[model samples]
Target: MKNDRRPAGHVVAIASGGLDSTTLAYWLKADGAAQLTLLGVDYGQRHSVELSYLEATAKTLDATYIRLDLSGAAALLAGSALTDARVPVPPGHYTDVSMRATVVANRNPLLLDLAVAHAVSTGADAVAFGAHAGDHTIYPDCRPVFVEAYRRMITVANEGFIAAGFQVLAPFIAMTKAEIVRLGTLLDVPFANTWSCYQGGRRHCGRCGTCTERKEAFALAKVFDPTGYETDGG
Candidate 1:
């Protein structure tokens, strides 16, 4: 029996350089799991710095990396704290209501469509993303239902253009951040190389919603975090 059940083919992954996406990159490339491409979309988020991490991960994994500048879209989606300087990045857990300030309108669908386009052009069999269970409550786009509907929509829209047996994978869909952290640890992923701050500080702000979630994920996973934080999170 084959040890890994993952299909063998070219795959394009939507990479954000955060822990979840970084770990997904590692998982996708390890042991020659697939022909991997890391696609980063910068929609003028406060932390464009995260793309730098993705660049480094691509180098380490020898995976092709492409960054699309979608900053123009941010002008219209500027109400989100990620895209607008006027809005403050909420500090707290992801489940907090205020964290909705981080949601960029139509963010996932736009990104996913771009990935699907690239996959069709390149004949890649899959387009994968990192949308863990913890994100389900925070972002409707990250929910399993959205993923399923997206797959169906693309299958119908692309019809015969996409690769045979094309797939949309969200491998961590059922997992919480802590669960992903554990899997990353087992995969020997260098967690420190990943970024999770909504702020583009030299180090993690340690108070933003994503930073708080990152801190909690490591603690819950019993993994030693190597990230530097500007504050003690007090």
Candidate 2:
């Protein structure tokens, strides 16, 4: 007997439990565009605790929650501040030079592979994630070129198995974090439930690149941020 945990839905959304992804979930649901399966990936990140927020988001959205653990890859993906204990998480603006240490080296392709595989396995038509404009500066994989090529590559990768009209969606691709925050405010996304700390501390380190970016996003959007930062750095 084979176990089948493949995500089954009109769209399997990768939920990172961060501001962008959580907002994406709420937006998709409220937009009434697609049936959602909130999928969370755990590649032994320092912030595995974010999965709990992901589960909370699933419940909030009343969507299927798939927590896929690829923790074994942590060893192979060492040196990244997120997966390596030795490398300290960088504290600065997200796009600054120091923040490059957070790159997991082809991380998005690996994560998106899960969405595609599950989409193919369950005959789902689409796979979605919340890669936004801010991600483009640091993450090569988050760029439109990569996403478009990835969609095509995956289509060819499983030509027979994939559903017709299958799509890899990154709706926030062109939008800024501030814009997303504004939209999330309109969507009533519980911002406090999202997690962005790379430190995985009791509260957001607030000094890390992501936290700084998160604070900046809220400020730029003129939205009141509910997140509690340990350092009050940003």
The candidate scoring highest on TM-score is: 1
Expressed as tens digits, the lDDT of each residue in 38-143 for candidate 2 is 8899998999888899999999788889998898889999989999999999888855477678989888888889887887788787878888888887789989
For candidate 2, the C-alpha RMSD (Å) to the true structure equals 5.5
**TM-score, every prediction:** 0.94, 0.93
State each model's C-alpha RMSD to the native: 2.7, 5.5
The per-residue C-alpha lDDT of model 2 at residue 144 equals: 88
Each model's lDDT comes to: 0.88, 0.85
Ten-residue region with minimum lDDT total, candidate 1 = 1-10
Worst 10 residues of 2 by lDDT: 1-10
Angstrom error of the Cα, residue 180, model 1: value is 0.5
Backbone clashes in model 1, listed as residue pairs: none
Clashing residue pairs found in predicted model 2: none
In angstroms, give how far residue 85 of model 1 lies from its true place: 1.0
lDDT of 1 by residue, 34-146 (tens): 68999999998989999999999999998999999988887989789999999999987765578789888888899999999999999898888898888777789999889
